[model samples]
Target chain A: MELVEKYLYAIGKKLPRKQKRDIVEELRSLIIDNLEDRVKEGEPTDEDISQILIEMGSPAEVAKKYCTGTQWLIGPQLYDMYLMMCKIVLGALLLGYSVSIVVSLFSSLSGSGFGQIMWYIAKNLLSIIPGILAAIGAVTLIFAIIERTSKKPLDIDFAEGGKWNPSKLEPIPKKEEVVKPIESILGIVFTVFVLVLFYFYRDKIGFYYMSSLGDNWVMVKIFSQSALRTYLPLWTISWVLSLGMYIWLLCIGKYNMLARVFEMIVSALNIGILFFMANGPHLFEFDKLGADFIDLQPAVDFLTNNQSTIFYILAVLSIFGLLANLGKLIVGKVKGRI
Target chain B: MGNNQHTTDGLIQELRRGTLVLSVLSQLKRPQYGYSLVQCLAQKGLNIEQSTLYPLLRRLEKQELLKSDWELTGTRPRRYYQLNENGKEMLQELSDEWNRLAEVVKKLTQEEEIK
Candidate 1:
């Protein structure tokens, strides 16, 4: 009887909470009926109970028989998009972090030996793995929520009173008009990653040098407090707008003239910010570079002096991007493709 | 050979699954508890598992095809299920459909055998 109780308890644990008590009670009645038939003279043993339970099926298998519809966190409709999002995000994280660590290693090479720098890179890389895992978990949770809550997941609404009609489906776009999902996904990932980096790790973006004590590496941030304070808000706004635009493009799965105009405006604003920084103030500062970086002082001085040149180069590249986009827009308009 | 047997068993299960609702509906013409229903079906050479039949009975009840009550007069409480008016109508329609399907299947199989 205790074995029978234990078996029922196991099955009850897996049963849906709403129907748990009633189902368990019905099962108990059935089990008792089986026992009465089998154990005519004496009480049914654990072996008898075990045999019945085994015949009934495993607890999970039994419970699954009661569950209706999808029992998964993410359903079939959103699974492909969720998987694509994960791959894009994880790939970006790996590439971004790897590049950052390698850059840090090279910058601090004069402070530490090659082996020591490699060791630091490995440790830093290992530490970021949890962050990557959290990112994947966040993505899975969001898709799961959408799956649970949305009647038509991923905007794949059934046409005309929920009856899916194949003939009414939109024709596939031409190559030129097709908004590449990968492009939008990559753009979203890059913008988000960059925004996070600038927001959280702005202070860490600098020359890494071994301190005079030789006990630890120190970072001398490239941007002055004044510079970051001035640009941070502007950078956040533009990048956030880019993020929104990419998300919109991803959802709509196509590009339009308005999107092109929005992109151009964002690009123009970015270039404007770059040119302003280049001309307005001495953005790079080496005040934190101590005597430890004396040997690297000349190189740092050169970089600080030519920081404006770097900004000019960035602005020029952005201008070229803007022109290229403008050219495409004009061509599209002329061809009546927009 | 083992794979072929497994495939055949799967097909047989699928075939049986299509008839399961009809079988359960047919039995509900008389009030029967879960275990009594299982026994009744087994006696009729249709051995449905308890796990499958119990949930199905609940589902049918929810669908308003069957009505159930907890009969607590015995030593242990038993949930007795019987066909409601809706259930009786559904059973009649399903029985007619099943007979029609059976005739088609029989004709097809007989023709195959002759060929």
Candidate 2:
């Protein structure tokens, strides 16, 4: 009985005080009833009682059955709130640190001395503060939305004898049920159109500006004069092919796989283009290229001369596009059948 | 139209069933043990079963919306249930919404009767 009490207490401690006594009392009675029954059957030894208790199962198991409907975590409920708050605070801090670093780097590079660096850091911190607050606000807003939408009770049951069954929970809204195929088709078409527009307008938008300023822009003149003129047509062609593939995939209702493949291909090609644009000039001097290839000089020279900067920009843009596309793909996947 | 009436009744029952938890939560603002709570609600015509009430109390306690503690009343220790802070806030909001809904429903039904 003492052993049973100890076991019951251990389990009861995990439950709310309101349930603890009832569950403990009920469990005690059960063990006593079991023991008495066993004794009546002529097994009166202490060893027999111990064996019977063991057969009844571990103290944890017995307590679990009695407190089957209770929930227990490592600590109080407020601890969860604290953890959530900490995550938000830490995320904000990291974003602030990165922004500060970028601002400082730019300020120093532009010949803004120590004072300017400090000012930039302060300005960056101030700018990021609202963003952090907005992120936190967004999280809260999402929580409110979920709370408002959720029709079920707050309890989550995961116990041996608990009546809680996850299967009984409402089914998640299916992706296909929510998003129609037409919407996805439109999205794919829109992205392709944007890519095509950019490709066609490459030269007019001063694609060669980064390599050759032509006495128009200081930043443009400083950078390599690699005219992306040659790659423009190829890029446009690739975009059209990728767009066609996307449309075909969407029509067949295989948007996810198609988007992933397309993103990977585009990212690879963009990275390659950026690399060539940055390194082509350094790899082959203008004297070697002769006057006939002067037009191509800007593209090659820009790539070779400003390889790091070009790579950084392309990598960033590619990664950003990849992430955006990946997000859409995942949303589409989760919204299954749509 | 006859089938529609039946469907509407069913929908009303379904809606009430969904709000049963909220109703339970509202009643548990003051400390009331399990049997007492069941009796109190039954007297008020909520008509909740013991099996349902017990499980719901457990669930509410688990959610931290309700707090429970055992008191040695008589020979048997009885578990007393009370609404927690979050439960109080939730009950207030739900009550306001419920009242507003009831008013709207009453006005709509009255308008229908006139028609």
Best by TM-score: 1
* Reference contacts preserved by each model: 0.76, 0.00
Say which docking band candidate 1 falls in.
medium
Lowest-sum lDDT 10-residue window in model 1 chain A = A102-111
- The TM-score values for the models, in the order shown, are 0.80, 0.31
- The digit string of per-residue lDDT tens for model 1 on A129-163 reads 89898999998998888888887645655568767
lDDT of predicted model 1? 0.84
Put down candidate 1 lDDT per residue, B20-94, tens digits, no spaces.
999999998989999899999999999999989988999899899999999885676799999999999999999
Q: Can you give the DockQ of every candidate in the order shown?
A: 0.78, 0.02
The candidate that achieves the highest DockQ relative to the unseen native structure:
1
Candidate 2 deviant stretches above 4 angstroms: A1-338, B4-9
